[model samples]
Target: MNNMRISPAVISKLCCLPAFYFFMFCSLAAYGDDSALNIELKLLQVLNLDAENDQQKMLGISSIRFLPSADPSKGNLILLSDDTGAVENAYGIFETPHTFDVAIECNNHVDGEVCQYEENYTRDDLHYPPLFTEAGLNQDQIDSNNLWCSMFYVGSFFIDSSPVCESDIEGIELLSGGQERLVMEEQVVGFTFSTPAVLHLDAQNFVTHKYTFPFSIFGFKRNWSNQNTQKTGVRPNGGFEGIALLPGEEGLYAAVTEFPLMQDAHLNRFVLFSLEESGNRMEDKVMIREHYSYNVDKVLPEGAAVVKPGYPKTGVSDILAVHNKRRSFITIERTAIRYINRSISSVNKLFLINLPDSSDQFSSSELPTMSVIKKEIPIDSDVMNNYNIEGLTWGPELAGGNKTLIMVNDNDAGRASQLTKIFIFEVVNL
Candidate 1:
């Protein structure tokens, strides 16, 4: 006798609001399939960060992140930029973003609304040559691809105090996890960018130090792990383009080869790195942990008309590890196809990667191609217009459950045809 009778008025109201009674009327609504990876995005707002007008701040943006704040409204946003100016590696930290224009959706995704950042600190080449050269990095290597950052936080808490991007911390430290170089053979070899630069900023955003927290070759410096890339290596400027801190795992991080190691050109390799400290914090090291493989898709579907003969230029640009989940991540696979005199066509799609729960779950022998990674395209090309999207991060949360996924594009060192852009959208299950 749990008899709860609903009045006609109540029933009428519930009927009028289908969404309000969705769970109660499950039989009438389409059920969700857990097997399928389904993610939906609703465009909420878009803005630009150029109100400050610094070319390095506006031009070659790579990744964006929020330095933790205790108060819901006080968090600071930091944007990493490439060495487009050849002056120094730079990034900007700003207060909450407020100014913007109205956003409009295009054929693929929403585009619009100019927003600017109220900068609190602009850190660039504060201590360039020393920080980089300590790990044997040269000037050219330091400037190429630096300062694409992804904060390692678990629900406002830092994974560890290694860099102090947390609420109660005083200083800020970030990794230049953008593209590095890969070399083959020996001395007559090409440049090898197997290291991620470390930039330390004091409380007021003044540069304190700069250096490389290096990754290696056969567990040695300047080598890009045991991938033995010496046979056939990553394309120029195509090494370690994507990086993320593994959620729930402290001091453990992940980086992926921008394109596949030339050996498995069709499959991208994801490598794990862990931080180990010595007596001195500056001398701490990031070493290789594990390796997993993922299959890459064509720039366009099989039957789509393409004007290119080779794979062209395609690879993962940046990675964002899902905060609540242990081993899942958001992978941005992008490609640029240029015609001699035709418009350059691009493919930028977002994929969901759920790595195996345990390292022992699968062996390399099992992978004819070591492409055992579980992947599904949650946001397909059909839903987004083609743009050379380089980076993404979790913006402010909208309803505690839904999050704002902010993505940015690189303007190729300020090219006329390519305008630096930022895109914001409401993401579910992200």
Candidate 2:
């Protein structure tokens, strides 16, 4: 029998070899499989819809949806318009502060017509004045304040234009026509509210609908009035900033940022509603409400004053609910002041939130709290510098079972930068 003795140096090298091999194996496995860390973003297209005049700049796209077309190879983009300024009044009197829908075709071709307009729905054709008046708003006041309903944003499935659950089942007819045609359900839905005034639009038309309820709906002791003061404890200005329809569920979730004027308010609230259809209007019944207090100071830049005396630190820019999953992705856009020169800079971060499983009943008193998973996705500085990125939606499916994320910015009014940019990135793991 022969006994072999290896030197200490040789033994150590052999031991290190196994560890190195294991590390490489794990790395290779992750690269091959669907892993979050391995997720890669690919910029596919940058559709520019800007024109020579201010009226033609398609920059104020606050909400976007990648609608499935008859041809699977091609996809349609539906954008909901909103104001870029803090107040809609920034658009001069001659420039009507109206919101509309613009549908464009996005194909594999990278030609000039790759993003040509397919259809246009003007505010006149989509605005429903009665929806506000029906909510106890005085028509005279609405007109006096120049408070016209404008679509702030939109949310829906990637393939379907409507919510996962038919809003009509809740006894609300969303279409101006009849519910006999289910195809109308696929129409783009928008949300409008009293912006810069306080009242929030919870939901809007199938493509743009704003639903308002008394503060009491959320267990608050305030009535809907035009006081423009927080003494009512009622949020009059911040309404439906972001929206996401729950996948494979009968629920619709929306986010409303607390008015910057509210002294004691630091939390942004998410309201859950049951989507129902009412004639020409999508009716949303408030189910439950949950609030999240974001750490603005941690997310903001140096010398930033997120919690100002009368300004909101962060706003819910956009929200997207992943397909066939109970997860919601939210983007928060924060404004900060630079320490050295007091210059203002914008910061954007994405939050992946886990939603509760669907149940037959939801109680307002005990709403489920959404927990954030990942919050490190940063918006490109160039995009933030030139435009306010407010619109976000799930893009079409990509090769290798990956997904796409589409973001659009709202270019400020009267800017000579007639370049509306669309950022497209493929989601590898998500």
On lDDT, the candidate that comes out on top is: 1
C-alpha-based local distance difference test score of model 1 = 0.46
lDDT values of the candidates?
0.46, 0.40
Off by over 4 Å in 2: 1-38, 83-91, 94-125, 129-210, 217-237, 256-265, 275-285, 289-297, 302-312, 336-342, 356-386, 397-402, 415-419
What is the C-alpha lDDT profile of model 1 across 44-134, one tens digit per residue?
A: 4445545355533455555555543443322345555443222222333321111121122222322333223443445543221123232
Query: What's the TM-score of every candidate structure?
Result: 0.62, 0.57
**Count of clashes, each model:** 9, 31
Clashing residue pairs in candidate 1 are 47-115, 48-115, 108-385, 131-210, 131-211, 181-193, 216-223, 216-225, 217-223
